[model samples]
Target: MSYRIRPAEQGDNEAILTLLQGTPQQGAVTLNFERQPDYFRGARVACEQPDVWVAEARDAPGKVGAVYNVGWRHVWVNGEVRPIRYAHDLRIAPECRNGMILHRLFRHLRKQLAEGEWMQTTVLQDNQASLATVASGRAGLPTYYPAGTIETSMLYTRQRMPRLPADIAIRQSGSADLPDIAALLKAQGQHKQFFPYWDVNRVHGDEYCYGLNASSFLLLRIGGELKGVLGFWDQKPIKQTRVLGYTRGMGMMRHLYNTHSVLRGGMRLPAPGGVLSYLSLHSVIVSNDDPELLRLLLDYAVAFFHGRYDALICGFFQQDRLAKVAERYRRRLLLSEHFLVSYDGDPRGTLDMNRPWYVEVARL
Candidate 1:
């Protein structure tokens, strides 16, 4: 049962992917968040210089028992843009999930982080096992301070796009729009904690914006002035969410729902083992955080992404007023508990509660 933790190399991709496939997030509809083709592709895009770690069985060489990653990027915190780490993709094989393995992994992780370095992570609210583990106060583990809830919605494009006002315009962005896009994102994003600091000029070459380009962004303009921008990213080429299985009752319920959806124009639930086709809505910024502007952008996005994706996914902290906009759509909601982890001190008290919290769902 001995294990050794080390920085993962290119050779560990298959082992890491295997571990991820075996560990599906349990819920009504179980899902396996998999990195296909290569695991590192998705990891590289998470942030700049992503550091991935893997736990291997000493008795069985090359057999990965667990995997984790720390992705560093500049984000707004307490009204300042600074480097922050996002800890994600912490997966352990079912056979090695005993407390000992997790503690060992954290011990090594703790050694790598600086004294006051704080990181953020999210656990699905329904993941009771994970929630309990984080709250367990295990030795050598960082303290996870409760932040808030992230409400992620899978909005179905079931309705037709609404008409826009004569002065309002929605169009795909061009290369010349980078400056204005950057300006709009920064202006609106500053009001939210953890919103990414965009390098719009380099987005096409940035790993964090992998599979995205200027044309992927949809701009909402009023009287020829940019008011909002939403970027659509399709990560399917690198990362994929496959339907693992549904709970007993959920399986039957999904069958009925799919029947009706197929008859209508709604998005039908994917069959088990099938990959979901969806686009993630990123860089979601609007002037004044206006719900009406967001609605207009989403309406145009629906038309822009129609026939190409089954659904569009986005997330907003429950405290965010704009979260109400998604509630009006035909959608399925998933909630995750956000946390700030630190070994030095708690970050919760220092944060301003008035600001909206934003975590790009695509990166997670």
Candidate 2:
């Protein structure tokens, strides 16, 4: 069967959602394609920008068989403002599993991003198909999760804050705090894709930030400057037995991103019920001299969450420095086996655990 790959149109929302739902592999991650109308709308709007592409079965007219959500961002790596195309969501319908779908998407995206640029994406360690997809491509060598422990930490109301020196203070962020938060994140060497340029605008524009149920965010300030930011959200603990239902028939069980796979093999840990939280110890930018400030900021963030939420879960990509600190707090390692797939470029480099990059936190 032939498929016509093109940009998604506004009219293709329902068809795209149906295609996503039909893919059993995506079902485990709680990616309720039914409720993501806005995300689809956003993607469609983004598709209008000439860089995004969608694949649809030609015979079925509007039925979107797959979506290749790609976009570019400016990165100031090593003092150069290089443009990097970041591949977000790459989904293919099970019926149309031809390898050529992704290959075509890559060729199209590469052509769109051809003017003096680079591309990059991260995949989980266990996703062999996606890992193979990217590794076998023309891109550079893919980076596997180097040996590093991913620590999970929970903050319940019962824990007490550790005594700290007098310079650091926790402040609630208002709309006025967005730009400063943006700057601090950029300064901490966080890639622009992690914290999209319009993230704050989207949050505050529709006052949708208030609608977030499981997540809460705050700014960490030291000496009255925005040193860093912390945010957390509650996630449904993936039930191991439930996940096995999907993986049982396969030769090699395919884990769903991070959340679902973490719960597999009875290794699942309990998550908080009321106001469960996932903490992002986002960028700690201190004066060139105050290196220890990062440690202090993290400690306080954990203590703050413990005082508020019932449990806290933080994601650590391989090679993240914060994972070392997470070890000291005795954070449980939840989902380290899963990988993310990016079609842009090689997946080497430090995974920034600080920013809200995980799929569960953002789209889930």
The candidate scoring highest on lDDT is 1
Decoy 2 TM-score against native: 0.62
- Give the alpha carbon lDDT tens digit for every residue of 1-364 in model 1: 8899999999999999899899987778888889998898899878766889999889999999999998798889878998889899999888887648988988898898888889999999888998998999978889999988999998876546778999999999999998999998888888789998868876667776778888879999999999999988899988998998888898889879877865554567788989887889899999999999999998888766766786899999999899999998777799999999999999788888888888798788
lDDT of 2 at 233: 32
RMSD of each candidate relative to the true structure: 1.7, 8.1
Q: Write the per-residue lDDT of candidate 2 for residues 18-80, one digit (tens) a residue.
A: 665564333333222222444454442222232446787777777777886656544444333
By summed lDDT, the worst window of 10 consecutive residues in model 1 runs over: 260-269
Least well predicted 10-residue stretch by lDDT in candidate 2:
235-244
TM-score of each: 0.95, 0.62
